[model samples]
Every structure is written in structure tokens, then in C-alpha cells.
Target: MLMDDDLFSSRPEDPLASLARQDLDPLSQHELDERIAALEAEIARVRAHSEAVAKHRSAADALFKR
Candidate 1:
């Protein structure tokens, strides 16, 4: 009974074994370029918005302190 439980409890297949045999889909050069450009634009927008918020917060705090 113990041996039977051990056999059942053991992982049936290795995930890495399957990964070793898998083929990855190739992305086109155009698609890769577009994705990179989109990510850069998004990062720039987020940084600008963050700076604006920090400036507003600083102004508000100075007013409150006076």
C-alpha cells in the first residue's frame, strides 16, 4: 500500500522534459519593432504624468504650511 501511494504521488511527467522538445513561434521583425516603439511611448507618458503629479503635490503642501 505504501509503495502504491508513493508511485501515485510521484510527478507523472517532467515539465522541463516537454519544454526541451517544444518549438517557439517566431515573431516578425516589423511586429517586434512596433511592440518596442509602443512600450517606449507608454513609458514616456507615465513619467511625464508622474512628474506633473509630484509638482502639484509640492505646491499644495507649500500652501497648507503657510
Candidate 2:
């Protein structure tokens, strides 16, 4: 009974969650270091987006203040 929009709106499994469950024991030291660097970069990207979103929300709230 699901509509087309409902089917497409559902997200696939979160890759970050999948990555956390991955077996890291098999990775070499260099591989682990590379993974750490990639994760750090992703963290920075997420933080920047979060700050931008917060600023946007704050501006919207200020504009609509009663």
C-alpha cells in the first residue's frame, strides 16, 4: 500500500553505523590510520554543517520573533 514517495523517502542503512560494526581487527596499522584520518575529515565536515544550520535557524527565529 506504500506510495512512490514513501518508498523513495526511506533511507538506506546508515553507512557510518555500518562502518562502526565493521571488523577492524583484520586491518593493518596503515589501514587503521587511514580510516582514522577519513573519519576525522568527516567529523570536521559535519561540524561545519551543524554550525551553519544553527546560524540559519537562529536567523529565522530572530526574524520571526514576536
Candidate 3:
């Protein structure tokens, strides 16, 4: 019996795709908690970067329109 590839291969382009497909059954409670903290931190970091980029783009558009 073979495991379905789709079970782990969804959205291969996603940065967190591999983590999403990981088996959490082998992780200890402490490890799972740590993983959640790490993912949260990463989400914050990505959001901040996105906001910065959007701000820069808006500023550039305004300057070009003037």
C-alpha cells in the first residue's frame, strides 16, 4: 500500500507547504508548542514585509502621478 502523493504535495510552491504536510504524530508536546510559536513569528515577519512593500509601492505611485 502506497501513501497518496497528493497528501503531501499540495501547493508545492507554498513556502509552508512542506510543514503543512508534516506528520505531527511523532512530535512531543513541547516540540509542537515550539513549532506553533515559530510559525506565528514567521507569519508576523511576512506580514510586516508585505506592509512595507505596499507602502513603498503606494508612495512610488503617488510620486509618479504628481
Q: Tens digit of lDDT per residue, candidate 2, span 26-52? A: 999999999999999999999999999
- Per-residue error (Å), model 3, residue 62: 0.5
In model 3, residue pairs whose N, Cα or C atoms come closer than 3 Å (at least 3 residues apart or on different chains), thus clashing, are none
Once fitted onto the true fold, the runs of candidate 2 whose alpha carbons sit more than 4 angstroms away are 1-10
Best by lDDT: 2
Candidate 2: what lDDT? 0.95
Mark the regions of model 1 whose C-alpha exceeds 4 Å error after superposition.
1-26
Clashes per candidate, residues 3 or more apart or on different chains? 0, 0, 0
Best-first order by TM-score: 2, 3, 1
Alpha-carbon TM-score of each model against the true structure: 0.58, 0.79, 0.74
What are the lDDT scores of the predictions, listed in order?
0.79, 0.95, 0.89
**Residue 26, model 3, lDDT:** 98
Structural RMSD, model 3: 5.7
Candidate 3's C-alpha runs over 4 A off are 1-14
lDDT pick, better of 1 and 3? 3
